[model samples]
Target: MCTFRMASNSNQMPRLDLHKDSKKLSRAQLDYMRIIEQQNLERVRRLAKQRSNNIMVGCLLGFGVLGIYGYSIYSVKQEKFLDELD
Candidate 1:
């Protein structure tokens, strides 16, 4: 019986084998790492939500400006202020 000390599969994708450290780490370290990962995930979600809100506000503001501009154009067309000179 023998071993090549490496995977013999040619089509298999190689990946990081961090499970080796699982046995070496104590409970406290594992818990701390889990907490850090969770915090990072939460921070990412918060930033994503804020970004969506900002985009929504910006879109509403832009539409408001466009609507006002359109109304001004319509009002100007309805009046004969410029036509009086012609």
Candidate 2:
């Protein structure tokens, strides 16, 4: 009877249940999230304002350069027209 024990040959691995114990957030956690979200929105607004002002300044400078270029071309053309009439 001592030499009649059977040998086991099992190779199965244990499985884990991922969702067996999940906890919900408390009210204070939610309030903190809301405050963080509000700060993010304010930051976005400030960045947008800065972007718009930068675009406006760029447009003004562009127009100033184009105005000078156009005036120079116009003066040259007027001078050529006057010379042609001579």
Candidate 3:
């Protein structure tokens, strides 16, 4: 018997399993399942790549902001020290 189940996550693809009799599935059914699986695999890969890129961009922005903040603090302290010398 061929059984199809929905994944726990609604965003994910359905899960298909062949149970009891492997030979019972028709050629068309097998072909359809194969196509769906391939599509899902491609979607997963694309999503993963996008997520990695987002993280990289976020980290770069965070570092840039921190650098700017640190530089401003250092400049303020330097000015204060120079003022005290005069």
Candidate 4:
């Protein structure tokens, strides 16, 4: 079990044992670990969202390029046909 004592001097920081093993961590250390874990989880979620957005943008750009290529081919075919008729 963890124990805490209030400091008599207002300017002094509370003493804590932060060097203990994980199984014997103090209350303050436990709270700190929880905060770190939550932050890491948030970071992972943000990275995943960014990756999905990049994939979507790439797919859209690829389709746009394909459409432009198809249109150019069709235009060339029409020009060839007109030349043959002349």
Cα-based TM-score, every candidate: 0.71, 0.55, 0.68, 0.66
The segments of candidate 4 whose C-alpha lies over 4 angstroms from its true place after superposition are 1-23, 81-86
Model 4 / residue 53 / CA error / Å: 0.4
Per-residue lDDT of candidate 4, residues 1-86 (tens digit):
99999659988866655565566776887998889999999999999999999999999999999999999999887776766787
What ranges in model 3 sit over 4 Å off? 1-16, 80-86
Per-residue CA lDDT of model 1 for 1-86, tens digit only, reads 88668757989865535586578668998899889999999999999999999999999999999999999999988997888898
- Candidate 3 per-residue lDDT, tens place, 1-86, comes to 99999558978855545875448779998899889999999999999999999999999999999999999999887776767798
Q: Between the candidate structures 3 and 4, which one is better when assessed by TM-score?
A: 3
Write down the RMSD of all candidates, one decimal each. Answer: 9.2, 17.2, 8.4, 12.1
Cα lDDT over the full model 4 = 0.87
Cα-lDDT of candidate 2: 0.80
> Which residue segments of model 1 deviate by more than 4 Å?
1-17
Index of the highest-TM-score prediction: 1
The lowest-lDDT stretch of 10 consecutive residues in candidate 4 is: 13-22
| Residue 39 miss distance in model 4 (angstroms) | 0.5
